[model samples]
Target: MLPILDWGCAMYAAVDCLSETATVLLFDPNAMTDDGAAAWFVDAGSLAEWLETWLAGTGWYREDADEYEDVAEPTPWETAASRIAE
Candidate 1:
């Protein structure tokens, strides 16, 4: 399993196994601002592609945050991953 994306409050990731194609999962902690383990399988795709599609799609957008300016910033998890890769 490879850790792909972290939205600070949540995570979008994938797993690879010899037995199956890669599976993407979304681990959302604060679903609709309510407390619960709100996680689900997203889809099968590379992290980059998935992230790009998400950013391009309207379903992930929230009108209140000034058109998702927050999306431009890398999450703490992503920063750590970049450092580790370096």
Candidate 2:
């Protein structure tokens, strides 16, 4: 009886482990994408480091938000132009 209970417990643990692994495997899009962008962007790195690297060489710093507040809202002309480009 004790041996049976141990086997049952081990089976239950193995099923739970397999369930979690399956969920992760199913949702991993990098396994499907050609360029593997997901793996590149989400590699072992700090969030701040990622953000800094992304914003580098671009003029779009968070500090510029206040400066552009007045012109932040898109004009109808700008929206129509963007839609046409898209």
Candidate 3:
């Protein structure tokens, strides 16, 4: 699992790579602690497509929240975006 965004609340967004696909898993702190409930699971395709899906907000990882406070800059996402530009 490659973590992309961390809220410092134990809730985080991560990418899980599988043999055939890549997925984004959003975990809720309390719920995960209680029942291992993932807030979101999205099949975002390959690494590049996953980044695109994230930016477009057309997948399971929607921009439902008003805003997200980044615990750190998501450098991987930036790197992926740059790759797409090339």
Question: Pick by lDDT: which candidate is best?
Answer: 3
Instruction: For residue 48, give model 3's deviation from the true position in Å.
Output: 3.5
Instruction: Give the local distance difference test score of model 3.
Output: 0.49
- Model 2, CA-based lDDT: 0.24
Cα-based lDDT for every prediction: 0.43, 0.24, 0.49
Q: In model 1, where is the ten-residue run with the lowest total lDDT?
A: 72-81
Residue 62, candidate 3: Cα error in Å is 6.5
Model 2: which residue pairs collide?
Answer: none
Residue 31 lDDT in model 3?
A: 41
Order the candidates by lDDT, highest first — what do you get? 3, 1, 2
In the range 17-43, model 2's lDDT, one tens digit per residue, is 222221111112333345332211111
User: How do the predictions measure up, each by TM-score?
Assistant: 0.36, 0.21, 0.43
Model 3, C-alpha of 46: deviation from truth (Å): 4.9
Regions more than 4 Å wrong, model 1: 16-19, 31-38, 43-86
Total backbone collisions for each predicted model:
0, 0, 0
C-alpha RMSD of each candidate structure in angstroms: 11.3, 20.9, 12.5
TM-score of the candidate numbered 2? 0.21
